[model samples]
Target: MTKIFMAMIALLYAIPAYAMDGTAFLKQVDRNLNPESYESYRKLINVEPDGRKKEYTLFTVKKGVDKVASIFLAPASEKGRSTLRLGDNMWFYIPNVGKPIRITSLQSVVGGVFNNADILQLDYAAEYTVEKVEQNGNEYLLYLKAKTKTVAYDRLKLYADGKRKLPAKIECLTEASMLIKTIYFKEVKDFGGGVVRPAVIETDSPLYKGYKSVMIFAKVKARDFRDEAFTLTFMPNLESLR
Candidate 1:
């Protein structure tokens, strides 16, 4: 049909070519996925091989590409716990502990496949550089390399929806390209105010063979915050922002 042919033609052109700038396209995808500054509520669930599950809800805020903070909202034990990230430096605060302690990118606040880097994630363009882009049917596959050794995943393979420019799946890898985990993004929903993207991100890792983690996003909104809100000194007051 003529309509189908036209749609195919449009997709072909939309797909990144050798002449297209990979970094620019990646940045576009990052923006399409989230605003430069925003607030969101996420329910993180961890599942075990025995079918046991644990869930925690968080109120997250981001000020820029480098600053992000989150506070746990549910489960009495983690309710007052907060985490902050200013670039590569991260800290976790517990109400009783009173002082913020440094944490690593690979450590998990909510144990499962997702680590600190994934929980307090910055913009993809902030941490990664596109090494190459390829078109796979209706999707665009992006090969990403971490700009620094401190990055959690040294390599990433991202498959994005060509039409929406949003990631459909991501494979996290080590320096040698060994697969660490696979994250699948699904259930796209519109959160309004120009925020529309996947609401569910489920992840599994071979390293944690019997474990899985999922992030369910809700009420995501585009908004700006103060840089101080992303500091260790502000971790205890993170809940006040919401």
Candidate 2:
């Protein structure tokens, strides 16, 4: 009888230790990945099924959860091109055209598996509400649903490191739970000034078959920027921020 009573007490105490608030836990994982506002340099590589590869470098900045801007830094053909995203609205600007144009979230800026939404991703906490959380061995699997219809992906399955609380993999999905793409976070590095997270994000999509895309991150440090810096008018002047 005493052993039964002790076992019941132990079970009662164990529940709260792993009994996590899904929403709060997801927010922690998001912050562990990146600051709310910051700047980063990324090299995007797109590999064709035939083994040919094309790469583009970009300098990117984000303010809050909704505002992000990026400018191509290499490949003369893609250089000077910029993209500005504010909430659900996104625009692409070409230097020769000298104007900003609307773009859909699923459209790729550099023509790869990654789309504009993937490139200019907002905080997972801001866009998704945790629908379920499960412990899968050493990782925590978080099932998320978009907070609004305008969110880029209707559903997301995120697998995060249980100890680090950083994402290990994320699966973007449609409303019907159809898989679109899988993003793998790898090569954790300390980027100085308290930023420590994945240095590489590789993605593959069923739609693209054997093609894959990778984004290598560097110099991801925290910084403050003006709201005007994320506007269409600021697209031409993005280089000035660097």
Candidate 3:
């Protein structure tokens, strides 16, 4: 009995206490990806099974935890179109529409596997609560649950690199545990000014077989913005900030 008790205690001590705090580690991963407030330029590419592709370039600005806005920069048809997210509310502005329309996180503005939620993504820690964490070889797998029903995905399985503390891959699932999509992060790069993270993020969904979407980060740097920059009226002039 004494030996069995000692063995159990040894096993418990084998895992570090800090590693057990999944929430703290999740926040670390979020900060490692980007600062709390920053601006970035990205190119989103959607490829069809027939070897055809469509691309859109965007300039995205985010402030704090609840405000994020993005404006399309390329493709004449999509130019001047903007999207804003203020907490749970989201709006889409089109040049010809003349007014912003309410949109949902599940809708895709660019028409691909990547949805609005992915394009104007907030900090992961903002929407998810870490349910548990496990160490697998040199990687850490984090299980996350959505904080509200409005979130795009109800659950997520995130695998992060142990050394770099960056997400390697993520599995987005429904509340019923149905697999929706898998996202892979690759091509780590240094964007200067203490910003270093994956330059490429690729995602594919079982619901849309043979279709893949890739987002490539061209530039990401820390920059502050005014509260007005994330409002509906200011969305039309988002290009001015660039």
**What is the alpha-carbon RMSD of candidate 3 to the true structure?**
3.6
Collision count for each candidate, in order: 0, 0, 0
Tens digits of per-residue lDDT, candidate 1, 66-87, equal 9989999999989999999989
Alpha-carbon local distance difference test for all models: 0.91, 0.91, 0.92
Give the TM-score ranking, best first. 3, 1, 2
- Please provide, for model 2 over 1-242, each residue's C-alpha lDDT reduced to its tens digit, 9 standing for 90 to 100: 99999999777544432477889989898788889899999999999999999999999999998899999999999999999999999999999999999999988999999899989888999899998887755678888999999888999999899899999999999999899999999999999998889999999999999999999999999999999999988899999999
Q: Which run of 10 residues does model 2 get worst, by summed lDDT?
A: 10-19
- Candidate 3: stretches off by over 4 Å: 1-19
lDDT against true structure, model 3: 0.92
**Candidate 2 lDDT:** 0.91
Tens digits of per-residue lDDT for model 3 on 26-96? 99999989988999999999999997999999999999988999999998889999999998899999989
**Residue 158 of candidate 2: its Cα lDDT?**
94
User: Candidate 3 at 121: error in angstroms?
Assistant: 0.4
